[model samples]
Target: MDTTNSPSSTDTDDEPRWKIVGPGLLVAATGVGAADLIATLIAGSRYGYTLLWCAILGCIMKIVLVEGAGRWTLATGHTIFEGWSSLGRWTHWYFGPYIVIWGFVYGSAAMAGTGLALAALLGGLSVAWWGILSALLGLTLVWFGHYGLFEKVITAMVALMFVSMVTAAAIAVPNVPDLLRGLVPTIPDGSVVYLLSVAGGVGGTITVAAYGYWLREKGWNTPRFMRVMRIDNRMAYVITGIFVSATLIVGAELFHAADIAVSTGDQGMVDVAEVLRDRYGDIYGTLFLVGFWAAAMSSLLGVWHGVSLMFADFATELRGLPGDHPDAQAGGRYFRAYLLWLTFPPITIIFWGEPVWLILAYGVLGAVFMPFMAVTLLWLLNTSRVPDRWRNRWWTNVALALIALAFAALAVTEIQKAVSGVL
Candidate 1:
């Protein structure tokens, strides 16, 4: 498949090896979507830099999770799904419905997010229509595009997002004293929920589970590449840290004024873009929206490609196909079906309001997934599933245990909010 200009080639390209863009970069771009941006923005606007440490902590948590995923695949020569199946059939029972329902709802949400930024940047259509268009665009790319091409495009978008937000924050001139104070980790009254969101929500999703697949695609799937995988994972989250913290800095500097009211959710980013127009100039505002669009689109594309690859694998395994089955790879029949699954039907939700029940089910299922992933990884890596040489070290097990507990708490909180919203 189309392999020219693939970032994977950087391994020996003699190009300046700065960040070493690879599966790690893809996971980084995929993990930090619009929701993560809004969470940090809200935290900053409400409490200034007081929650900055949470962003750091969130990244550390994710690093552990992604490392575990990658390690399992390299050590066991099996996909994550295969590892889970060895545990028993219950995993299939839980994962089957969760992936299907989660993809449907998440597809609409992602399209709307990209649409929001697109409509703001270009004024010809409603956010919903723009969202539908974005879905189609994402579908086209992932459906026909090779992994190498996809990686290059994601790298460009991530660069735009990083530059736009960090540059905006720099122009705002952050208060060093306030920022320094934020590192002390004291939670103000009523800051519990926002703190939880920032600490746990930095950059995570089922896409973290897809890290291994990207590793295999990049030809990094062996014990020999363990050191490289660790570096790639660390650098990815380090980049994630900058993306999120720069957004928080933007919130703290631009939206902290008493006159500015920050909207919750991804729309809040659009609101900030308008503020940018007034505060900076048309250039800055347009830049900000373009950055936001890059972010939303990068994330949508990542999920479109990564998670669909995952679904393809899941389907292939269920059909008793070999691990090397063609239908499980990117652009294969199963993968294309999932890409279509993520694209077309969600357009109806974007057009007319769909029923709430399935969406709520999606919410509840999605909420529990972080913990599910964490706990399962803890089990898989600790037991005989992975080789003794590559099993979790003491520190790794502790980290995963703590992550599982933290995610369990966040899942419960998310479920409560989902249920309360319906009531």
Candidate 2:
């Protein structure tokens, strides 16, 4: 199996095993943050096995979006940021401010989530200290570890999360009949929040844009790698789909039976763990908590690495510099600057509460990003920029259009909730 993403490969007899798995795993793992888990768990608990179809749909949408990202990279030999830039300066105009602001706000939140999960698993430290430590650890690893090293770490963490979480689900022994019923794909009454969450939040974010950067790092630079890239992206999301489905199954079987009410936010996973402990035992609950920590940490590391690369590219391009120029690649001035922005400035938010207005802005920016990425890819891939063979198929365009609309609707509701203090 050749791990090289270049078009020079000629080996015809290899197994093509692990080489097929690329940065798609990192993207899928990064996208399935703590928030996604809680959403799935809540969906299952509130309406047992009813909305499983949303999770499946979410996976399909991700595959389409990610493949678009990878296709643009391989076809054009340009990053997604560069592809977006081909449209005009306005693409950078929107991305520049959004990346900086999003990083500052999300950095604190992600580190804090990782810390909370670690605090639950390890007994002595407060969440604040744990969060600070987690942030530093992520910074250290990515600061030294380039793309390959970063991919290995995220893959291992995601694997640990899959094992423990799925094991817990297996122990729960969900009813096959009810699980099958979830395939019908209907939204139940009063399940608006759950529906939006499962449909919109299943393994998605601005990090999807990072797919190109990771492909670049993986050395997938030409059209011949297209088949391998597609396989990698599909396999990664399928694994993500399984992990999410297992979470839903556990939620339906365990919490639905007990009538457990899950709260909103990352802490909801902890709440579920407690319920599991009461019914099953400490070992089961502890194992699940460990899995939860792995998920949170994987997300934290991925954002720390991927978004820093994005911000670095954004800053360099704003200065009219090239990507391979000295200051745009890993550990360069722009990259480290964004790294500091992601790791340090956000600590202030940890001390002083996150400002309501800034939080609102974060929600607004985040809401727009998915649609922005999808719509931009639709434009980039459809034009003469890519060869006809690499251009989106009819079904691909339809899927992307639906994804854009779905994300737009979700964004509107998010803004409304932020305005109403309901999010």
Candidate 3:
């Protein structure tokens, strides 16, 4: 006798569209971080509204890239690592070294970045101490909390960031005409690198690659969730665009209009917060710092959970274990190991600066990853690997191809910048 319906059918029917937007929102908020904000601020200060179009393009490019990643996972029950494995042994060859080296460098940078924001907010502690504290706190939270709790914390932080940035932008009262004019694509003289950086780098990073694993965590393994996943991805990036644009607006109105120069890196954000305080008094500046800390913390928490899942899966595959092995799930041994790797070793960078060779390697590898991801997605999605209905449409192919080309150019530029800096 057939029951009302199978358990799977019942599960599908009960899942609402809105509930599934979690993974996308998590990825978008995590992707922005302090670096993306710094990039946007620099762009706004240098070119005003002239390069605004590039930021929007960046958002679209990320949507296409992330969508491709999510679609592959839902259409195939295999994890993304498994799909990469299907490509060849070369895939593992690239990812193995890349993750290890990149994680070592990035973990430190992320911690220092978060620490800088916290130190700015607190006003008395040294940046290094605050950064060390942040790393330990992030470790404790991720180590003990399950995915559901982690997701909730990230969502709350995202809300804090959005409110802070949007409110700051509103208070700045950007020139309506210039804001509208920025929508037109135009490049100022000697601004090509800034243009390319903004166009290709907005909210796009290794976190985009983490999308598939996040989907698995959210239980969107079946093909039925594909449409919902697409909707979620698109909406998240749209929100990302708004958040980014608000920062740009703040930069244009606050720094550009006053002919002020902010410093480089994450510290520039602190400088801007100080300027805001000096100009608008303590409350406005405090709000901006709060937003800055939220953004940094979101990135920290995200990489802690998301990349740990990725490393655990990689370790499982390397050991010839099944994908569903419990060790690959949250709080598993391998996951905790990577989470610790992301937390503790990086603290040493606070006392001793990053090595020259390490920075060069991080730059070269980081540059190539997006193009690698784009080209691979094009290969995986077009072949017999995915179901016919799930295959990328013609327009999707064009978007991804452009994304690959753009990223390749950006990668070359980044490598050049790294080499030049070393020289």
**TM-score, cand. 2:** 0.95
| Model 3 worst lDDT run, 10 consecutive residues | 1-10
lDDT of each: 0.85, 0.84, 0.85
Clashing pairs in 2: 5-220
lDDT tens digits by residue: candidate 2, 1-423:
111233433431254746669789988999998989999999998899999988998898888888889888988887888888899989877888788789999899888888889898896998878988999999999888878888888888988899978987898898899889898988888997678788777776888988888887788777777767877888898899999999998889878877978878888989878877997899988989988989988988888888888888887887889878877787888888888888899999989888887888788888889999889988998999987767877777888899999888888888787777724
Error of 2 at 258 (Å): 1.2
Give a tens-digit lDDT track for model 1, residues 265-351: 888998888888887789998999999999899989999999998999999989999778899898799899989899987877877
TM-score of each: 0.95, 0.95, 0.95
lDDT of 1 at 244: 87
Once fitted onto the true fold, the runs of candidate 2 whose alpha carbons sit more than 4 angstroms away are 1-13
Model 3 regions lying over 4 Å from their true place: 1-18
Tens-digit lDDT track of model 3 for 297-349 = 89888988898899999999989898999998888999999988888887777
| Superposed Cα deviation of residue 154, candidate 2 (Å) | 1.0
**Deviation (Å) of 146 in candidate 2:** 2.7
